[model samples]
Target: MNPAGDPFLEACSKTFEDQFSPLEVAGIGSFGIVFSATTKSKSHIDKLGTPQHRDASEGSGTQALQAVKLCLPGCPSGIKGSTSRLQAEIEAMRRVSKNTTPSVRHLFAELYAFNTSNEPWYSMEFILPGVTLQQVFDVASAASYPFPEEIVFHVADQAARAFQYLHDQCRFVCTDISQSNMMLRYPGKEVSVMPDLVLIDWSFWAEASDQTTTCAVRNLYNCLAPVFFDAGWRCSRRHDRDSCAASGVFHSC
Candidate 1:
């Protein structure tokens, strides 16, 4: 329960660990804490002299914006052991990255799995210039603010694309698709046509399996009832993850 004495931090010492400087707390999940970090590779640090004095450009590159997630055992997100679930997520991320087309792959972040002192964790891209759909909905509803129909259409299109890529291409289902699990890129911007959205929270994102049907139904309820309905939109799609695969579709793209 101690922050400073946490296993993830304790395991991370030298070996690229020093490269990551945690700037602030991102959010807390049932089992872990996330940090928005400024990270440089070992070579990047050597070139910059001090990791502390790294300029904005240093963190502006490919590995610049990253999210560090430290796992806690038996988190509510996992039905099996936390370690097993963490490994599964790493696999899922890779599948999406390697199996999908470049345009579709760019819509999601890359994941890297690391372990130190027998403690395992992963770091991923921190999607920014955006806010969680949950936060957006809660605040707007409280203020009785109604977003334009244009924004809704944008959101709908982007979400459909992301979900299709996951289901048909990645062969994974976002079994939990609540507002918090979705984000709208570039929040507060007036320009809206195709809503730039990204799906977050891989905890319940699983490969298409026998249990996908139940998960899909539950996910539809969690996602549809509150946000879409409140926004005066209706969306429904049948969940058939298994059948959606391999219509002359190779696992590899």
Candidate 2:
């Protein structure tokens, strides 16, 4: 659907006083649709606060682009927890932002603002000039060029640190770990310089204390651990580690 005609976008425009101008759909899934938008006025940017890694060009009278994810009502088919899930995702982002060290925090996108009043939605930092690991793998596969061992290790090491923070400090488990969830910031940078790996999509994160099964399992068969296939196995920090390892192997193969 066109952004202008989308009900969710219309709601956002009305609710936020047209501060955000929708550019295009960044992604769409069963739970929500993420729109790439830019701030219409300086006041809006002020209200959301400046991102730490924003380029100098953006500060030079340029509209700052962001990602807005609007919840889809009654999502996940029969399930009706879309709004709650979105809230959880926002809370997780905020927790990580407040507690992690600078290096580890940069690995996760920053949350700007969120609302659950009517058409639930949230805005977050948009990674510009970035490429998902999935896209990189696809290109390499098509060209029959495997990524260098050093590059692989670099990505893996950064990802491992991020997961460790989420597990040990934040006490959360990113139930979803896949190639598409990891992005290489500044992919055009010199090969000698390792690009920062930014992890996205916290839609499936669960707190370590929560013993309940998660809906994330439904779509994460390839990355999920074998224990997840058991009848009543609950999510844990190990699940994320296993999933990360599986995703690494899957993408590198």
Candidate 3:
């Protein structure tokens, strides 16, 4: 961590203050800057995948107090297709928070209160000592290490549960499900050595109101339902099902 007394930290602190009327910036993301406070929180705007990161721990957290995602106001119009996508996402998140069941890992950080000081910023929980799956994958891949079957089964089960909850209970489809958004919990002495996976980031959640349009954007297309490609793809739930299935196979003897 940079020195708290460093000028950069002070500048970030000032940016947070100017936006939230006295909050401190805790971190930044591709879409906005995240600020923490005693009573409220705020985030500044930026483009998709534009939030910079110095490390991977930003992705973990199981409870509201564990994490937050501040969103930007306007998109380049050329890129977002519509400016209200962010706002729509916020509303979608509200629905998700209410509809979420206990068994599933909530894909979004809960909005405690929003900062209306400027643009559109909202405060949410902060994940403590949580790490993103992307980070774990990097370490695993870089080390050329193969995860044990038992560990893979353990982590994959958690992710599958989260997916099943979203699909069955919430009647929602996560438009984005990838390593980058999955998080690992804070370790405790009693915690299983098996890694825990938590779903995070709901910017691309799908609902009944959503149109049956094809998403060609790299973000939405890569993990899209195969039905998206063939239009007659047999297994409608191919996306999540296949990913989890593959992991399961890897874990099974």
Candidate 4:
């Protein structure tokens, strides 16, 4: 460590104001604990942050809700690879959001990362009034109803396009694809039209370098939430066809 310390280190330290209203737990996993919140002002939005989609008629004062993830309190301070992993996530998210397309721009939320030396956290566009695919399946199950296969396929179709944007335009791979990673924003709205689907989680996504090799980049896949069905899913993975196949969204893993 340097004697005077690095002044630029403070640049990574972020603080929140009353502008952000904390809601509930978005999720909890080895990756980190996610919390939901709402932004009170447009200024709160980071430089590369995604402004919440608002109807032009609605005019000004459009607040964007967002989700934030932080390391568990009890995590060891000097634990191996902790800081590096969080930094990696921030880098990957920045790269993906850098070259977003018109249709797939909303596929992932804008990342706002910070490192306060002792703790690390990052915020993303808060997806409100939404439910994950897992929640949808559970509710349908509890009601003794089947989750509409048509709606499922529609969401999958959109998600496939998102994957195409990620792979083709961004030179990135979504190593983790699953129902839990898929979020839907629809309520008091008809499902007749396709609901907007947002893909979350970038813990394992990799940026493909120009000198990418098979075993180094193309062959890797997330083993979590493996829900493979008979749609040539493995063939796509084995032959690196997954980079282009939009059909993988059906299995979602």
Q: Estimate each model's TM-score.
A: 0.67, 0.70, 0.55, 0.63
CA displacement after TM-score superposition, residue 54 of candidate 2 (Å): 3.9
Colliding residue pairs in candidate 3: 29-51, 30-50, 30-51, 45-72, 66-126, 66-127, 67-125, 67-126, 67-127
Query: Per-residue alpha-carbon lDDT of model 2 for 61-163, expressed as tens digits?
Result: 6666677777765345212566677777888888888788866766787686777765545545555557776777666656666455455556656766777
TM-score winner, 2 or 4: 2
TM-score of 4: 0.63
Which candidate, 2 or 3, would have the higher TM-score against the true structure?
2
Clash pairs detected, candidate 4 = 65-126, 66-126
For each candidate, the alpha-carbon lDDT, in order, equals 0.56, 0.61, 0.45, 0.53
Q: Write the per-residue lDDT of candidate 3 for residues 144-170, one digit (tens) a residue.
A: 565554544455456556565655566
Q: Model 3 misses residue 80 by how many Å?
A: 9.7
- lDDT per residue for candidate 4 within 1-253, as digits (tens), equals 1212422122111234445555555555555556666665555554434334443113565555666665544334322344565666777777877888666766675565455366455445445457776676566545656444455455656655666677777787766656687778753123435567776777666765554423222232231112222211233345554464434543333
User: Which candidate ranks first by lDDT, i.e. highest?
Assistant: 2
Question: Residue-wise lDDT of candidate 1 within 145-173, one digit each (tens)?
Answer: 76655566556555656677787777778
Candidate 2 vs candidate 4: the lDDT winner is: 2
Ten-residue stretch with the least lDDT total in model 1: 244-253
